[model samples]
Target: MVELQSGYKLKKLRSDRGGEYTSAEFLQFCEEIGLERQLTVAYSPQQNGVAERKNRTIVEMSKTMMKEKKLPYKFWGEAVNTAVYIRDRCPTKALEKVSPFEAFSGRKSGVKHLKVFGSICFCHVPNQLRSKLEDAAVKCIFVGYGKCEKGYRVYNLQTNKITTSRSVIFDENSLWDRDTQTVDSVTVQIRSEDTSRSSEEEHEETMIDIPSPPQVLAHAKCAAHIADTELYG
Candidate 1:
C-alpha cells in the first residue's frame, strides 16, 4: 500500500531483527522493491516503543483472559488473538476516546457481535448437511471471530475441527468450573423452538441434543491439538 498523506512510494523499511523480516523471500522482495532496510539490534525493544508496548498489553490481556476463563496454556494463541481484536475496538489512552479500529476505518465497529472468549456455543448443522434423523446443531467452543467472513470461529468438540459459522447460538451465561475430571464429552439436551435456531427454521424442533463440553479448562484440548489449530487454523 502506498502512503496516504503525501502519496509517496515506500522507500525504506525499518524493523527489529525478527526471523520473518530476515527471511530470504522477504529480503528478496524488499530488494526487488528498492526498499532500504534498517534493522534494529537484537532484543532492543525500546527502538520500537509503540509496537513493544502494544505487544506487552496484548500479552497481559491474553493472560488475564485465559486465567479468568480457566482456559489452559494450550489456548494461549487464541487468547492473544482475541485480546488484540477486543483491544482494537476499545478506547485507547492515546486517542480522545477513539478506538484504533475507528481511527483507521473512519467508522465505529459493531460491538454486538462480540462474545465471551471460550464460551460454549451451538453451531447449526444445515439441513443439507444432515439427515432428518441427525442432530440439527453441534456443540462447540467459541474461540474467536471469523477472519474472512461475518461469523464466529468455533472449535467443534465432537469432530475435533475448527469451523467458521454465522449460524451459531452462544451460551455465554453458562461457564464450566475446573473441578471434574477430563472426559470425552457431555450430552446437552436443549429444548428448542423454531426461533431458537440461528438460521430460522420453518419446522419446529423438539430437542437439540448436542455434545456438551466437559468440565475441563474452558477451550483447551491437548497441547498438540489446540496449539496447532490456534497457530495455523
Candidate 2:
C-alpha cells in the first residue's frame, strides 16, 4: 500500500538470513515480482547497518517512553507503535530536515494534533452508553494515534481496554499515576464535613490564639529561605 501510494517499486530487499524470508514460497514471490533478495552473512549485523540501527532506535525510543510514564510492561506494544508514529514525522539528517513520512508521501506531516503519550485524559462517552446522572467523560490514558482514523488512541482505565476516539480532552500536565487524586478528593470532602461539625460544636468555647510578632517574622524568614533554596537549587 505504501509503495503504491508513493509510486515506488521494490527492487531489492536486504535482510538477515531469517527463515521466513529464506522460505521457498518467499523466494518464488520475490522472483515473480522481480525483487532481488540481499541476505547478510550470519552474525554480521554490520552488513545490515541501516536496518539494525533503525531497530535499535525504535526499541530505545519505546523503552524511554514507557519508563518516563512508568507504564506497565504490557503496554510496550503501544509504546512501540507511538515511537514509530513519531519517528515517521521526525526529520532525519540524511533527509536534509525532511521527515520520512514527507519523503514517502510527497507532503509534510502535520503534528499539531499530537498529544503527550501516557498523559491523563478524559474520553467522551456516548450518551447511549450511560445514564443521565452518570459522568459524560471517562478517565483514560493517552497511548498513541489511530492508524486509519483521525483520532487518538487511549486506554480506558475503567474498562481495562484500549480504544481510539477523537473526542478526548487531554490533561498533559497530569499522569495516570496521579489518578488517586479523585479518591483523595472524596476523602478530603468527608474529612471536611467531620471537621465542620466539630468546629460547630466547639464554637461555644471562647478560646483565641494569635501569633506573636517574633513568630510572624520567623515564618516570613522561613518562606524567604525556602524560595531562595528553590530558586538556586
Candidate 3:
C-alpha cells in the first residue's frame, strides 16, 4: 500500500522481532516483493528505538486528544488516525523547513480546515432528504476528516453512525451536548472521591503551620527543661 501510494518501491522494512514480522507468510511475501526485512534482536527495542519512540508518541498524543475533548472509547480508532495525521504534518528537527508529510508527499498538508475532534457539528441535510417543513440540519460529533472528499467526518447521533459532509457547521467552543451535558455512558469521567480528598489534604500539608506564641514558648521551655535535666542528672 505504501509503495503503491508513494510511487516508490519499499526497499527495506525495519521492525522489532515480533511474531507478525517473523511469520513464514510475511517473510515469503516480503521476499516475493523484493523488500528486505531488517529485524532487530528479540526484546531489544533500543535497536529500533526510533520506531518504538514514534509509536509511543502517537499513542500518548491519541490518549491526550481523546481525554482533552472528553471523547468516548468508541472513537479511539478515529483519535489514533487523527493523531498520525497531525504528527505527520508537524514540523520536526529531523527535517529542515518541510514537515514529514510534506517530505513524503511532495506537498504541504494544509491545516486550515482542521477542527476539534469531538466538537458538536450540524451537518446540512439536502433538500431532497428533508421534508418541506422538516429541519434541514442534523446534530453530530466531529470525528475526523474525509479521506475521499474535501469535508469533515462526523458521527451522527440520531443515525448512530458516521457520515461525511462538506457543509458542516462546527461549534468548536461546544462539545456534543451543547450548552450543558448530562451523564453520558461512553464519555463521562468517574473520579475517586478519596483521591480528590487526598490531593486537597496534600496541598494543605505543604503549607507551614505556624504555632501560637504560647505554644512556641511551651515547646521551647520543654526542650530547655529536658536539656537541663540531662546535664544535671
Q: What lDDT score belongs to each candidate, Candidate 1 first?
A: 0.74, 0.76, 0.74
| Tens-digit lDDT string for candidate 2 (1-233) | 75788787878999999999999999999999899999999999999998899999999999988877767889899999999999999999999989999988888888899887877777767757775445656778899999899899998878889998998766664555545533111011111234446554633343333333233335544554565578778
Worst 10 residues of 2 by lDDT: 183-192
Clashes of 2: 0
Worst 10 residues of 3 by lDDT: 182-191
Error of 3 at 105 (Å): 2.0
Measured with C-alpha atoms, the lDDT of residue 134 in candidate 3 is: 54
RMSD of model 3, in Å? 23.3
Write the candidate numbers in order of decreasing TM-score.
2, 3, 1
lDDT of 3 by residue, 1-233 (tens): 77777898779999987789999999999989899999898889999899899999988988888787787788889988888888888898889867999998888788888887787776767757865445556667888888788888899878889988998766565555423642122323333345556554533323333343233335544554565478778
Off by over 4 Å in 1: 1-11, 176-233
lDDT of 3 at 48: 88
Where in model 2 is the C-alpha error above 4 Å? 178-233
Per-residue lDDT over 1-233 for candidate 1, one digit per residue giving the tens place of the 0 to 100 score: 33684467888787898899999999999999899987888888888778888899999998987776676787888888899999999987788889988887678998999998877777777757875445566777788988778899987878868889998777764444447623233345555566666675555545544434432223323433454468778
Per-residue error (Å), model 3, residue 226: 92
